[model samples]
Target: MNDLRIYIHIPFCKQRCSYCDFVTYDDKSYLMHSYFKALDTEIALNRQYIEKSNITSVFFGGGTPSYPDAKFIKAALNKFDLAEDAEVTIEANPGTVDFEKLSIYREAGINRISFGVQSFENDMLIIMGRIHDRSMAIRNIKDAKKAGFDNISIDLMHGYPLQTEEGFRNSLSSVVDLGVTHVSCYSLKVGEDTPLQSMLDKGLLPEIDDEKDRNMYKAAQGYLQANGYIQYEIANFARPGFQCRHNIGYWVLDEYLGFGAGAHSYYNGRRFSNITVLGEYIRSLNELKLPEDYSETIDMEESIKEFMILGLRMTDGISINVFSQKFNRGLYSVYGNEIKDCIDSGLLISNGEKIKLTQNGLDFANKVFRKFI
Candidate 1:
């Protein structure tokens, strides 16, 4: 069986965050009945994409996958030929779900829970326009534990407006105290057209300083490392074997099928994305058609460049042996000059067969990535 991963996008949220620009809604509760029907259709239609493949992971990312209830999720559970021990994950928002809801999800086959706990500071949560406060997030964590969730992750954001180093430390410490299996720490990027961007444009928000962001990132790495978590990916830290396999599949450039509005998929060297509108997605799927709004078949050269960039995102880096075996070309011959440039500038280090980013290289990773482009 071909190895593949599955992603289901649940685009409904109780309320949208200020910095979020993802396709999602707050008034879609009434549409849940129809939404599940559409999901059922989409699942059946896309079964061919993962045909003869043992689905290794199933991820429910969102707005908040747990918002519509576990019944909505259970409706589509049996549609795919998932592996017996598939790693099924769902993102939950605090104050929107409780131990009862989490138990229902566990019964419905979700084994991992990622809570969107941006910070442990109530004031910071309010400034970020989050619907739930720090106490609510803590409550949800405790509830998930009571509900028998062992693989729980927390989504943390740093470098928010007016956020200090001490505040970031406190946030990380809280998660460490709770003994979360995984933690994804990301800096606040005010995406275009987001409410946070608008506030910044109007001088109502302070700019997130780059130095502060870097400091917090480094601090998180140190804190998590001390707490027995490994920084396996750029922004993700995990305890032992608890790294998010679903996301790891993406970084490793493995084939995966995506369903629902605004979800993107990559299979057979082609990339496709569904329409961002929920109604449009359902309408298209209702017509027995895939809701692919845009797609691209990556060319050879572009594929090689992408392979290098994506592989470098992981701490294990890229293996020269694997590159040669897969592409039948010497790694040094293909991008010898680029590799030499990066190594000479202390952005990349090579240990004969494998290459990885240095500490300084990680700080300026974007610049290094651009070199391949």
Candidate 2:
């Protein structure tokens, strides 16, 4: 059986950011007890999948996995039949983690810590409605190291409404200075009906600069690599062997089981998700029913398209031999025209048995991906 990965959602965020649309709650912390009970029930109910495959990685993602009592996280993690050297990780908010909580997490088997330190600029943190300042973020990294957590990562964002190109570059520089093992840098998207979007519409905030966003992204690619980090994926950079295994399992379309409300799963070509509403999620589990809300069996053509689109997101790109072995089809037989077009346009490079994006392709990645769709 292939390696199975697990994603445990902890939606108890202490506060919500302005440009967020993730299914998490700041006001619903009062329901934490019931939610964890539901999560436990959901995990127990997936015994068949859990037993068959060796769980290689477990990711505790969140509103803030570090915000909740550490005991809750430990209890939930203990349910997994994990491999001995499993790369277990927890996503944390800098202001939410401390030495005590981190110790509990390490004791419970977590080996990696990923902090959500969006920016080094204090004013940008405030604009994004984040609680932690630059100092707190730096302190959290130091404290995690003190807690004996060596494999650490941090999340960063670019393209805020008033963000300058230099500011984003500085954030990247700070990460290199902090000496964390991994970095995931994402461009901010102001969702419709989100507070940030509302502010833009009302002229309360300036618009995000597209040129600056692109420049910042390109800068990180150069700067991080110069500092000895490798760009494994479009948004992720890491020291060699420090890449996020849980996410790589995702990009490769490997089987994964997700627990907790609003969680999604992909296994055996089937994609499914749990009920997103907190109240309803808890109620279903209480009634001894699975909280699965929706599912779909991916068709062959859709699968091929996804394989190409997602594979291209990684810096290593897609492998020809693996694709052929899995699909039993020649690479050029299906998407030869698309591949040739991308290569001709200076957007992709077909080197030996691997196909990947070119330097310019990083700027117009969506265009290359759109060809497959």
Candidate 3:
């Protein structure tokens, strides 16, 4: 059977974070029943395609997956005949989950829990407009552990407004001390239309300097590496075997099916996404139709470019041999000049077996990626 991964987007949250631009509704609890029904319909409609594949991982990502009752989560999982050892993960907010809810999740076949604990510092959390305080974040993590979640990951944000290097380091240290298996440290970016951008525009929040942001990122990379967390991906660090399989699938160009509103899916050489509007998504499912808003099959050139772009995100980089084997053409035959330029500029290194980013390249990854584009 073909290896496959699945993602379910839950677009409900108790409160939206200031920097978030994901499609989510805060006061849409009244739509939960209908949403789940639509979600179930979507899953069932896609069952035939997945039935021939060995489902490896299923991720519940969202506004706040754990904000909903466990029954809703269970209902979603029930639609799939997942592999026995599948890594089922649910994204949760620290303030939205408790011991009871976590226990329900554990009982419902969720083996991994990823908490959106942006920071362990109250001041930082407040500035980010996070719903949970430091205490709540810590308490919920402990609660998740006690509720039988062995594989836990928490997201930490760095380079927030008014954040100092010391503060960012402290946040990393605190999460490391939590004994969690995985850590995803992200630098704060003010998205367009987000409250954070408005804050920056009105001078309510200070802008992050480029040098300071780079320093903060380097600090995380150094600290996490020293503490036995491997930097498998740019922003993700994990203990020796705890890398997020679901996300790794994406970086490796593995096929995945995404369900629910605003979820994107890459499968059968084509990419598609569901409608972002909740009402439309539900209405389409109610009409017994797939709620896809857009889809396109990528041509060979676009596929090759995307493969390189996504593969370069990993620290191990891309294998030239694998690229040639998959594409039926030599990697250097197409991008030999670009590769040589990057190497000469100290952005990439190749041992002739694989080509990967150097430390400086990691610092200026965007510049390196643009070369492939």
* Top model number, lDDT: 3
Worst 10 residues of 1 by lDDT: 43-52
lDDT of 1 by residue, 30-138 (tens): 8778877888888787767667789999999997887887878877766777798899999998888987888988888888999999999998998878889888899
lDDT of 1 at 181: 100
* True-vs-predicted CA distance for residue 145, candidate 3, Å: 1.3
Backbone clash pairs for candidate 1 read none
lDDT tens digits, residues 147-241, model 3? 99999999988778888899889888988889999999888877789988998999887887888888999999999999999999889999999
- Backbone clash tally for model 1? 0
Q: Where is model 2 more than 4 Å wrong at Cα?
A: none
For model 1, the superposed segments whose C-alpha errors exceed 4 Å read: none
Instruction: For candidate 2, write residues 218-311 as lDDT tens digits.
Output: 9889999999999999899999999999898888888889999899999888999999899999999999899999999998888888899988
Worst 10 residues of 2 by lDDT: 189-198
